[model samples]
Target: MYRLHIANKNYSSWSLRPWVLMRQLDIPFEECLTPFESDSNWSSFRTFSPSGLVPCLEDGERVVWESLAIVEYLAERHAGIWPTDDEARAWARCAGSEMHAGFSPLRSLCPMNCGVRVRLHAIPDALAHNLARLDELWQQGLERFGGPFLAGETFTAVDAFFAPVAFRVQSFGLELGAPSIAYVERLLALPAMQQWCQAALDEPWREAGHEAEVQESGTVIEDLRRLS
Candidate 1:
């Protein structure tokens, strides 16, 4: 059995990627969730993950770190990690890679906080650009591949890559076009996402750094998380 190490679901967007993918696809793995320390997780995480990062996969003697790397590692053994169609698979890889490497502004400006409803102070130019690009990419995939998931009729790695964005859009009330908005709604409605959200809301651990980042980004209108 594989052991997947991850952090708090509310704040760790990187952790969400592989965790959601495995759950949604019915891939078996033991989840080891270690909530972030109020101070720092570097020393603690280093014990299991070389990079001291969450979402590290331990497969027998081998270890895989990084969200994208974890996805690819799973894809090697999983049948439906990516689309089977040649063109769809290529496009999914490109889009998923773009998500892994790009979208810095959206990531920083609207950090993932699943249990909070926040009103942003302002949408900076960079954030606006990121949203525009997200809209464009999602539309292209849906139009080309046809359907509810990013790559096709079924969910793929690309959709899992953007799962955190769905939480972000909901938490910050970020606006997108009709199709993209629908896409976000669809993702949020997924059973895996629903489970993640419930776990987030039920969590009592709140790291100071993550809370500070949320306050820095915007005014938190509602905090649905359970009291610490």
Candidate 2:
């Protein structure tokens, strides 16, 4: 069985990616949760991950870090995780790569906090640009592949890569076009997402920064659930 070390479910966006992939694929794995912001020394993570990041996958002697790398590794092991056709697969890779490298401002401003939903008062131009680009990408994907998913009928790594973006857009109360809204609804309807949300709800660990932000915004955990 694969062993996955992850951070808090409520805020670890990178952890969610490979975990969602594993769950969606019905891959059996031992999930070891390392509460983010805990005093626990993450020395063990360094042994497995060069970057000392969460979402490290240990498969026997092989250790893989980085969410996208882990997803690609699993895709190699399980064929259907990526689109089969060459052209579609190429587009899927492009989508995943863009997600892996782009959207820094959105990530910085709207950190994933499954336990809180605070409306954005002012989104910086960079973040707005990122969101606009994301809207265009979603539109392109829907146009090229049709409704629901980035690569059409089936959910792939590309979809997993953007799942956090869906959460961010919803959490920040960003305006989404009809197509993007529809796609987010499809993503939320996935069993994997439901499971993740449930787990996040049950998790006890809460970062102080996130808590303070929630308090300042006057948004509670219940408010966050409503956003979902």
lDDT values for all models? 0.94, 0.80
Candidate 1, residues 132-210: lDDT per residue as tens digits?
9999999999999997899999998999999999999999999999999999999999999999999999988888889
Q: Which parts of model 1 have CA positions greater than 4 angstroms off?
A: none
The per-candidate count of clashes, in order, stands at 0, 0
| Model 2: how far residue 153 lies from native, Å | 0.9
TM-score of 1: 0.98
Highest TM-score model number: 1
Cα error, residue 24 of model 1, in Å, equals 0.6
Model 2 stretches astray by more than 4 angstroms: 38-44, 210-228
Model 2 clashing-pair count: 0
Candidate 1 lDDT for residue 77: 96
